[model samples]
Target: MKWYFVLACYLLAPAIAFCNSYGMGLTNLNLAPTYGKIALFVFSSLVGSDGGVIAGLAACGIIMSIVCSAADLMQDFKSSYLTLSSPRSLFVFQMICVAIGCIIAPLALWLFWTAFDIGDPDGEYKAPFAVIFREMAIIGIEGFAALPKHCLEICCVFFLAALIVSLLKDATPSHVSSFIPIPMAMAVPFYIGAYFGVDMFMGTLILFAWQKMNRREADGYAVAAASGLICGDRVWSIPAAVLSILRVDPPICMNFRPTSASV
Candidate 1:
């Protein structure tokens, strides 16, 4: 919450980025939640429990942002490596994007909050991640024993299964191991819901069709198309948020609900 804490986070960004480049990003991600909890515990001890939750949430955001930015930078570096492009240029571009995002993301959130009731359970945007984060923060503050029994059991099962699969994947031949389902990808739907999985499935099917049609052009076309789609999806969010601010409700927004009153 203090200015010094904020400055420390910025100063640590380059170190985080370096670690990620060397494949230590996963280690950082694994440790981040624990570190956040420790940071929150310290903040609570210093400031009392009254405003500690807000400070804790800010700490979580800062940690998550650093880890995510580093992971993204590593991805960009991989893309640049494959393309024989300049990593410095990519890093500069990413920094510019991060600066813009830091300004724009909060504005979009504020606009949406103003335009619609955000925290309502029945709202169009359920803010599922926010709910998850809040629950995690509570767990951090209280302790793991506070988590539901069934949730703990399920977590244990998945953790064991993931460990086994990771060992198996490493031991197996590369050609055979390529078929193994990514543990993270398999687990994503549990946290983010099935919509993202559905989108990924659809994209895979499209890519398959493209490869079948023309394997030669598929690589180039697929990369270009995927990049365009990713950019378009994010770019559209800005205008959509602007429209929300302008109170422009389109017919497409209404289509989310059923038209039949009988239902």
Candidate 2:
């Protein structure tokens, strides 16, 4: 199933490239950091398994990789389910949304580049997928042999850290498990560490300032702020909110599942 999805991505690569180049426009600021971790995970897993050097290590790396990517999607999904929205509908909506965005993105890029003609006169536009693939290759070359050692370190650190935190806070084991990966990813990767730190601090500050308000109210503010940032205009406020909802993945796998889910 996973391989099929990967193959499908390749099959649709041309369309995705065209969309990115011509339709919706592209910006390095937002997309680069978001996709970087994703690429790291993908590449690390693939490269780690190349020689079948360490079965256990490879397996753990793959799991961490999935957890890393899923964390990003899960946060957005969590926000979506907070409001009234159907889970199945939101899932389908994301599929359609990404398909459209991937197809139109290239067209948007071409226009932006042509308008500015600033950076590369050669019209060299690297699509998101290609960038991801390149990063994966780089990760493979760097850690292909040392994969087992790395994987052991990751698993040990992940569970031990989670356990320590859970014990110290009197939280459940599941709570620790659910919350551990995001911070773990940040620890090794400097760029991701900085970004997550900033984002978490901002979220904490917002929640602290709005301490008197209910969760629902704070959620509303966060959603509004996120929407405004994403849409670039108020006309997209509603749709952005809807997109936020659509992106939320159910927390069937986690203990910290938002209390707001209806389905």
Candidate 3:
């Protein structure tokens, strides 16, 4: 399985590099889904039910990586074009970062799992994304009709609301539209916990204030600052997990739940 994963990564690297060179976007690419289906069939045939599940997961991961890399590479290409930077340099740097991530991500996950119970109902980290993925996989295998009627109805409501909001955003003047909440932003809290949405709202409020105070410097620094915040949050999790494993908690309590006594 490890060898197959490595082989797939090796094969994908050149394909991604070729696509990036041609400035081709993956938005309309039908190749990934086809490849995924083929992989699913092959793995299922080679192993059994277990292999089929593994293959499905592997295929999903591969497809996601390809799509994400395509988007990131396209953005990098556009940025390079605007700045008159070397595409070669950008590609090299991207590959270096990718290699570093490949090494670091598994290590971080291992540390996290070792330090604390993941997917625990009463644990701080419930692994919501994992639950979402598992449910999605079950739906994929059982067919959309197998999903609960209430869930389907909720989805329809969100979809219709999003459509209306999208139309309004298109029709409204830019200044007015900018103030309107995105349908996705409004809907996400229903699926994910409210704390995640709170972080997003805080970030949005900070950016809004920054732009209102000085539009010029905001344009230059807002993206960099936000990117740093996002990356720092993830990077800090590694050390925090390490501290947890070492039985050394931070001086300040980062997690605070409201208790009846406090109330």
Candidate 4:
């Protein structure tokens, strides 16, 4: 079973490489879904629904773990390179951290699971990315029928647009091309939700203002500031989860969303 998966991954290496390369992926995690979708499509064609769905899901899970770890370790490796730290020592620490995570993660997940309805349609903690991935798997099984009307055509249009954008970027100078949005960047919000777009817009707006005011400080502190904001946001979730488990609900919680539509 393990070797079958290994062989599957080995077979799909070219697709992975192509996606990573042509998609302009800066990190592994974001590109995992693309490869997963590819795997799902290929396997569904090669084998029947029963085997293929399981294989596709298994591949997706493996890919997720692989990419997540790769992205995490790559950041650490780059930081180590900058600081002149021992790679062996860093690897040892990473292994230790992984061991700790293996023990701690389940407990943390249990706490959250108790606190919130994770995948509920009307729940506060809807797992949108999971929904998207599940939809991809369903589409793999049901073919074009699972998708919204003209969804495939829309995707084709975007695909051509992306290709054209890529070519124009190559043809144009750096200054001109920098203004153009990459397809992958655009796809992030599409895969996740509109929230990411809003988040990015705010970040970009702040950075733009900062740059106009003080380019040097903006350039120096932009990444650090963004990192701090992101870290704080995630860290706050722990306390929020704890409060939820304690049966304390925030009085002022509000939700503003569009009418329910499967996008």
Best by lDDT: 4
Give one digit per residue, the lDDT tens place, for model 3 in 1-263: 34675476557645654543333332212234333443444333343444445654565566556655665777787679768999999999999988998999899989999999999978999988667655445444543454577876886887798889979998999999987776644654654568667867898899999999999999888867977888888898899899989999668776576685552
Model 2 residue 88 CA deviation (Å) reads: 3.4
Where does the lowest 10-residue lDDT sum fall in candidate 3?
Answer: 21-30
Q: What CA RMSD would you report for each candidate?
A: 9.4, 16.3, 10.5, 7.7
How displaced is residue 68 in candidate 1, in Å? 3.0
User: Candidate 4 has what TM-score?
Assistant: 0.62
**Could you tell me every candidate's TM-score relative to the true structure?**
0.53, 0.36, 0.49, 0.62
Q: Candidate 1: which stretches are off by over 4 Å? A: 1-62, 88-139, 231-263
Span of 10 residues, lowest total lDDT, candidate 1: 23-32
**Candidate 4 pairs with clashing backbones:** none
Give all candidates' CA lDDT scores.
Answer: 0.68, 0.49, 0.65, 0.71
lDDT per residue (tens digit) for residues 89-115 in model 4:
998999999889888988999999998
Q: What ordering of candidates by lDDT runs from best to worst?
A: 4, 1, 3, 2
Q: Which regions of candidate 3 deviate over 4 angstroms?
A: 1-66, 77-139, 184-195, 247-263
Residues 1-263, model 1: lDDT tens digits: 77776676567656654544444322112234444545554444443445655666776677667766777777777778779999999999999999999999999989999999887889887888778766555555554455577876896898899889978889999998988876756665565577657866887899999999999899878878876876787799999999999999887643355666543
- Could you tell me the lDDT of residue 214 within candidate 2? 74
- The number of clashing residue pairs in each candidate reads 0, 19, 0, 0
Which pairs of residues clash in candidate 3, taking residues 3 or more apart in a chain or in different chains? none
Model 3 per-residue lDDT at 23: 31
